[model samples]
Target: MAAAAGPATLPAVVEELLSEMAAAVRDGAPISDEHLLSLKFVFGSSAIQALDLADRQSITLISSPSGRCIYQVLGSSGKTYMCLASCHYCSCPAFAFSVLQTGDNLLCKHLLAVYLSQAMRTCQQLSVSDKQLTDMLLIERTQEA
Candidate 1:
């Protein structure tokens, strides 16, 4: 999405999350309500880390042998989210810069999708990382790796 104006400044609160959803539509994903609810949120997060914005591009359930505990977000809308497990971040272009330059977290649309996509952890656990959140929101891909 470079060479384009950055994602609109969407405050991370639950109410403004739709702006990021709208951003995804602009970005070309055309998120459906079914896609939106895929995040499988049990208790609402105060601020959406990833799934609240864009669907986790790709998901690998890293922590789950049964594939239930942990999931990883690989990419979205053909954009690969290279989320390094170390720094707690996603390689999504949106997180490269912060619009406000003040918040501890830059709420990008990809992060929003982490909570909105369908392929989620059916089991419950504690806190999850941003990339893991991305995994939670990913739609299952038919193509094999």
Candidate 2:
């Protein structure tokens, strides 16, 4: 981090890194050592998926039969996270449970927290916005794709 940079810069940098990681994991390759190192440096491996995004969020990491990555976001808060997998389904109990028991609308605080954290790290126009992060996600996504 540069002395001139603000406290928010770090998370923006980390988001760029995570976007790259997301693109990588989406591509069906095993996560590389360099990526693990980045997570360690950025999030300090404090939580389970902190090392692996899906894990820290308690997402059940799975892949479609065709090999597309799938996530079962098992948030204890009873809400689900987003899914970018081919089918793109989230598995929070609130989603399924309510859908089953009653036709109720749903959005989750857990997902909000996770998304904000991720967005801060990845989405530059977000609260923790940074140009470097925005460019990096697209760059990594394109390069990997």
Candidate 3:
């Protein structure tokens, strides 16, 4: 008998959907309702909150001339959390507890907001120098320390 393959992980599924959404955006095509439904079904409340955050224009994409990008998402609590989508990292407590510590969730709502805002082309973009970006990271780390 053939061995059974494991099901795709939630992170992998989310990545696939995000890729499709990005491609659609690149092609100037609207994201299909089915895709949105799939996202909502997969992510549940996180997805719903992310969609709301994106719609509210609470995400900012800060980019350096060298092409590195970071995201800042304003939480419902009115605090901004730094999100690095490439590394799947967020400075939110939910991310630390749920995603990193307990591993109960693959991502927090802030990361979802970043991904959704990015895919939907809804993020506010700001360009700065590489040094400035580095400084921002250093400041964030210092604050955490």
Cα lDDT for residue 29, candidate 3: 98
How many clashes in candidate 3?
Answer: 0
Measured against the true structure, the TM-scores of the candidates, in listed sequence, are 0.31, 0.33, 0.81
After superposition, candidate 1 runs with Cα above 4 Å error: 1-57, 64-71, 74-77, 82-88, 99-106, 118-145
Minimal lDDT window, size 10, model 2:
119-128
Best by lDDT: 3
lDDT of 1 by residue, 15-134 (tens): 344555556765667656653453234223412444522222344434433333443454435544533322334545455564235444444444444444322322123465656545
RMSD in order of candidates: 14.3, 16.3, 5.4
Off by over 4 Å in 2: 1-10, 47-53, 60-145
Q: What does the lDDT come to for candidate 2?
A: 0.42
Q: Report lDDT (CA) for all predictions.
A: 0.42, 0.42, 0.87
- Give stretches of model 3 more than 4 Å off: 1-10, 24-30
Instruction: Tell me how many clashing residue pairs each candidate has.
Output: 22, 6, 0
Q: How far out, in Å, is residue 85 in model 3?
A: 1.3
Q: Candidate 2 on 19-109: residue-level lDDT in tens?
A: 7766765676665788667655544423233233433445443333343343334455544344333322234444455433574422232
